[model samples]
Target: MSINQSTIKKLYGLSAGRCNICKRVLIEEDVQIGEMAHVIAKNPGGPRGADNLANDNRYENLILLCSIDHTIVDSKPNDYPVSRLHQIKNDHEAYVFNRLSNNRGYFEDLLALNTLFKYIPILELRGMAMELPSRISNRFEAKDMFDNFIRGNPHLYPFKDRQLDRKWCSVISNMEILDCWILGSINGLNLITISDMYNSDPIPQPCYNIYVNDERGYMALNKRYLSPEQIDYVSTEVHRIVQDFIYSHTDLVHYIRNNFNEIEW
Candidate 1:
């Protein structure tokens, strides 16, 4: 028998209108690009077919995939075996549910949370922050790093949980401020200095001579510089912001770990 409308709805809805494999958007404003592929073929000679399995068109026996993935899986049934397809379906649905539901304790949630790190350079930033004056060769490069972080906002996994959402927002906000500060300094609208004190002495003490600029103060500096004490204060604040960003990422990872429970295979 052909798959019923209710089964089709469940397949598409549970997959969240995206391909189960590549996570590509399957449904758009004027197009439907999703294909429901059978895990066990209806005919015994078809890809992944079985001789005794009955009612092959049920939801449990199907997966939603993009046109490309559907073609790939059907063309290579040995690689995309029945067990593997079912696992993919379960994981994708769990990821969708974790994003949408408040309950939030799926094994897939940890994977989803870690996936965000791939889109941005948080680890690189943390390393640079630790090395401080020695790591930053050009001030504009630091600005570029922050720009990358801001651009990754659109690609991050959408967390529907209130606490997770709040932490993500705070991370984005702090990154924006740092980006603005670096850009302002580069343009000579504000001043930010990096230096190594005691360079003349045998032991060089690397230091970041940062200058604080409020939103309005971006134009106020106007190529002027700050005193040594003022620089030290601003540098401390900037370092704190970077620390907070790192802490936020850590907090998100811990939150996912605390709620994680293994899915039955």
Candidate 2:
């Protein structure tokens, strides 16, 4: 039996408008959503079965993901950078085309549209659907979402109800923020350390937080071990990192001081 609309919507809302794995937010103009997948592949029972996935609809068992994610999860035992990821992508592409040719004909209809958009970069093409399309035959056409995602448009995706584990989210977001600060400081695209930020005093929390949101502040507030001076230096380094490039220490410092834009320091 097929999962129903309410079930899909419940997953979409639980995923809260982002791919549960990649955190890519879907929106209009590009990047459509993909299918609602089974955490356990349907072929486990030799054909699709309600009993196989009915108990696994919670957000933990489910993930709202990009089309690439569906191919990724066809990973046996499901993990990344694994050998299976490559094979599944190639195979899924072929399978999708086969399904389309059988069900929707070789011409571009619903299934063919889904198949073509799944593999093609639909962002460059005349899109199949700019917004969510109304269902045909009471079934969501999977390809419509695929077309939108390929084009970089956003869409809502659902997953089973469960909390997202945010530990890595915090880490990655902070890294991006850190990278932004470094890029601004050195402007040279070189590495800067956390300790460097503290050397410069009077570090403004807001300046750094914008890149990663409040994660940096919260992390600093909790780690009270460092001295005020050290933290200040680290904060300044962060600012410096975001402010100028770091090709050579002497050159960058000379450049920044020489060209200090009279912005924050």
Candidate 3:
């Protein structure tokens, strides 16, 4: 069976643009010279033939290789057996995956730092006078709430029904992010002056103008900045939170629907 483009692309990314056998960079000047090699030849009576070809055209059975190494491995299957090739492919993919994860974390940390820079200035510029310390503490609380939400930590909400309370409180906590943004905007802070942390995804028109949102509307705002996989993860989580809120407070949901415009959050 022929390998589809999707499988080939996944193998290309997993190999991290390098040859699995030689561990050499496979692309130069945007031209990909690497080849996809089958760990098990499809020929009849081969050691790793038909029975072992379940994932033959998939990432699991594919290895990236330079032109020379591809010819060498295919010619010397006895030397580079199936087990050895699998080991090499897995090890390389693991290393690349870890490196990418670490880099992503590093990038997120930088974004957090930039957000802090914007946040601190807004608090300071507000000039809360005697309540400055308390206001700053509130800002810290807001940031902590957001941090816990993003990291999937259960927030400490003081109520008998912890699950529902957390779901409700999470919505409130997210509101604070917007509260700070509005405060900054009102105080003549250039919209451009602040990092577009909240605006990473397109802000819903209502969230900007009217400030009304249901769980899905909120999801559109909070999860807009996430990657497709991350969006799926956060979507699942937010859906659960919304479900919990609805199940616990069915009457309130109806009330909100009827009086949402008049109900000042």
Tens digit of per-residue lDDT, candidate 3, span 125-231: 22321222112223323344445544642322232233433544554444454345434433322321124434554433222211223443221123243346543
State residue 208's C-alpha deviation in candidate 3, in Å: 60
Displacement of residue 181 (Cα, Å) in model 1 is 30
True lDDT of residue 176, candidate 2 = 46
Per-residue CA lDDT of model 1 for 174-259, tens digit only, reads 55555554554444332443221212233222323333334532223221345566556556756765677667657754654455
The runs of at least 3 residues in candidate 2 whose Cα sits more than 4 Å from the true structure, single-residue gaps closed, are 45-61, 76-265
lDDT of 2 by residue, 26-109 (tens): 444675565565554455441123454554544334445677766666543435332343344334445545665544322222
Q: What's the lDDT for all of these models?
A: 0.63, 0.39, 0.53
Report the number of the highest-lDDT candidate: 1
Clashing pairs in 1: none
**Per-prediction TM-score to the true structure, in the order listed:** 0.42, 0.26, 0.38
Model 1 lDDT at residue 24: 96
lDDT score, residue 82, model 1? Answer: 92
Quote the lDDT for 111 in model 3: 46
Pairs with steric clashes in candidate 3: none
* Greater-TM-score candidate between 2 and 3: 3
Q: Say which candidate scores most in TM-score.
A: 1
